[model samples]
Target: MKKLLLAAALMLAAATARAEDNVVKVNAPPESAVAGETAPAKASTIDCADTLGVSRVAEVDTAGGGEYGEQYPPKPLLEKGEVVLTFDDGPHPEFTRQILDALAAQCTKATFFHVGRMLKEFPDVARQVQAEGHTVGTHTHTHRNLGGASMGQAEQQIESAINIAEATLPNGVAPFFRFPYLSDPQRVRDYLAKRNIAVFGIDVDSFDWRWRKPEKVMHNVLSGLDKTGRGIILFHDIHGSTAKAIPALLAELKARGYKVVHLVPKSRIETVAVAEPTAAPAPRRRARRHRRSKR
Candidate 1:
């Protein structure tokens, strides 16, 4: 009877240990969870050189060029079969790393327009972006729409963003700016122009901010690109949906024979012009606006 009870107890202990091991395996974070994927997807690789070619270009100088606010797309619009990948409002701890992993796997480079506060909060993530050979730009300090802010408020937003980005990024900040909500006032445009900074306007808006699902975000981006052929594609890395959609997006870009153009500012933009009080542009169609879902 003693031998029988001892054997049963040992068996029960072994089973309990196995159950605990199984629990740990299931509860631990996944290695393949990058890009917000809950499970590992089939691995694939892309050679950007063979799939999407890269090019170097100077910033578009829009000073008094009448292409100031909503009209600014990269001058000499990207040629057919070419696309510029840019992300705004990022350095998100979860999604940014996933996006970076996807970009790295594809061996592609992109520009990240980070909010100042986000950058400060995730300095290591910002450094990771730089370490991955991607360009870093500012999207204002708090992401407040500069169009409505007072000149003092607007200057503080832009200047503080630049200062924070420069302090955090080893490569310093790139000379490119994107208006939050695509709300660019002529006053802000002129300020950037005077400092020789380039203002970015999107040709293809991902609208990922609206659709949080990866499949839907992928479809929206591809459909937008289909209409425009090639230009700057706006995405926000802060969105987990965007990160989840990127691998599929890159795959589709390869399938469609689209090329990725990586834009690097000719040099770092460090100067800030004295704020000049000027009128903001009258409300025009918001260039960065995306379709709102009724549901």
Candidate 2:
């Protein structure tokens, strides 16, 4: 009887340990576990099981410029109907939260390239972004026209913006960047490459900044997608119209069978030596400004 009781006790202990392991697997890793970790397991926050039609694709980190200027899609490239959602120039007090809520409702994740100054002013919003499992990156200190600025000015804009973002984020910033107005200078491109930071350019511009009507903004985005097939789609969270359009836009994507791809840097960016000086490229015609209001 003593032998039998001892064996039963051992079995019970084994079962309890297995149960504990299962619990840990279901829960997110502790905060300490995420520190310095590049690819921690993400807890599923959205349930797409019932035809909302969302699916998460593999995490991708892209570098190098592409044929359409410095803008390039993900390295492995997206399949037909795959879309990577990206928002820029925000942490707008009114709209960022609304956008976040809409995204959470759909269990969708996006990459936000924030202006450094905005992150500093809205640290809570920035933290909320990271806490909810979206990738965050810098968009320059003041949303300055880096392509037209001197090398020193451009470097300051890039470096300071990154510093501010890193300081504000609980999880480290993703090693990704997007140029303001989609303008990237060759010299700036070289600097980012050496530091292992990837520069992002949009395949589809929602023109949400220019279009205040939600219906019109939604139409522009879907039309652009129709043209491009698949790539990163850009919007500005600062715009009330864009925030208002998100839910309808998400539904349209779902109805059209589009999948969302969440991007995470495969490796953290390493510190590098000072950037080399390269002659500034010839000035090009400045694009009409959407960020002027903030500046």
- lDDT, each prediction: 0.65, 0.66
Kindly list the per-residue Cα lDDT of model 1 for residues 1-295, writing each as its tens digit: 6674344333323322222222111112334221210111122232234422233322332223223222564345456877878899988999998887776555566888898889988999998787655678788887777767877778877888888888887778876788887777888887777766667777777778777898988888789888878777888998888999998898788788886665555446674543322333333333343422110
lDDT of 2 by residue, 20-88 (tens): 222111012233232221223333332334323224433333333222211443444466787888899
Clashing pairs in 2: none
Measured on C-alpha atoms, candidate 1 has an lDDT of 0.65
Indicate which candidate wins on TM-score.
2
- Candidate 1 lDDT for residue 54: 35
For each candidate, give its TM-score against the true structure. 0.73, 0.75
> In model 2, how large is the Cα lDDT of residue 181?
73
C-alpha lDDT of residue 215 in model 1: 92
